[model samples]
Target: MVVKIIVSTDKRAVKEENGDFGFILWEILIVVFLMGIILTLATPHFGSATNQVWIRIDSANRARIEGAVQLYRIDVGVYPLSVTDLVRAPNGMSEWAGPYLDEIPINPFDNAQVYQIGTMGQVK
Candidate 1:
């Protein structure tokens, strides 16, 4: 759609063929500028919201790992020495009814490393 504007006191078309082409360009520029401003103002909030979601996801993962550790201890009568023991049955342990976890969960903050377990059967 093309809009024609009359910039005269009499409100008559100044040039029908041209239709104030420069004015249209200026209008487009103004719209783009407004969009930039909006994006700039909104970007920080969006980033913070994304971080909050990651925190929640990691918190739940920590709880899940802690629960698995507790179960492992209850069955084996001691905390596993490492996180991997949750996902692999240790040798020479008859009471070890694991793979308590299907696999060690990766730390959300560090994808390459699995979550650590504390000496007292806590997930770190």
Candidate 2:
């Protein structure tokens, strides 16, 4: 007596039997590389937008400080000699009505608490 055996040549059947059903390492690496490129392209725009927001905030703070100084002058009849004069009354001035600001704001760029008073009551 004699026996015969046959084998199936289908690629899908072979793959299923071997359990090879996931991405290769090279494919994953390629995806990661593409994502890095996309992020590199987008990073500059995000940085510029953040800078613009900081600029606007600094301008608004300057305006508020200037306004407070103007109010101080209006009440006391002389411009403040320094930004601190807005918060504290100088000697011999009875018209001081405030701690004009809750706290002095710091410069965003330099992290300095100092301010320069320009001509015509502008804060720099």
Candidate 3:
């Protein structure tokens, strides 16, 4: 078996002899930069979506609380003294419709500096 090898001195003949790595590095940097921008742009959208979901969850919880209050009102003659009163007995009652709720729901918007405003005024 005989092997033949040809060697060339032409600088252009060598692959990546001039500025190849630089261009590739630049391309990679550009791609990385573009990805960072994409993520940056998408961050607020994710936050907005999360906020919307939180609002929905909070609204549902508030509605459930209101329903519990209404049930308490029906059982009693009038509205309770406060939100906590709905979960507790009115005192001097032999029997009542409830234990209306298994447990009192917590205000979901407690964090994030959020506030809840009802018809009368700020409830929580």
Clashing pairs in 1: none
**Candidate 1: segments with Cα more than 4 A from true spot:** 1-12, 17-24
On residues 46-86, what C-alpha lDDT tens digit does candidate 1 reach at each position? 98998898888889888887888899889989998888888
lDDT of each: 0.80, 0.81, 0.65
Q: Put the candidates in TM-score order, highest first.
A: 1, 2, 3
- Ranked candidates, highest lDDT first: 2, 1, 3
For lDDT, candidate 1 versus 2, the one ahead is 2
> Compared to the true structure, candidate 3 yields what TM-score?
0.68
Tell me the tens digit of each residue's lDDT in model 3 across 1-124.
9764548764445544454433346778999999999999999998899889878987877777677767776777665556556557767864457777676666555644433334432245
In order of listing, the candidates' clash counts read 0, 0, 0
Candidate 3 minimal-lDDT segment of 10 residues: 114-123
What is model 2's C-alpha RMSD?
4.2
By lDDT, the best candidate is 2
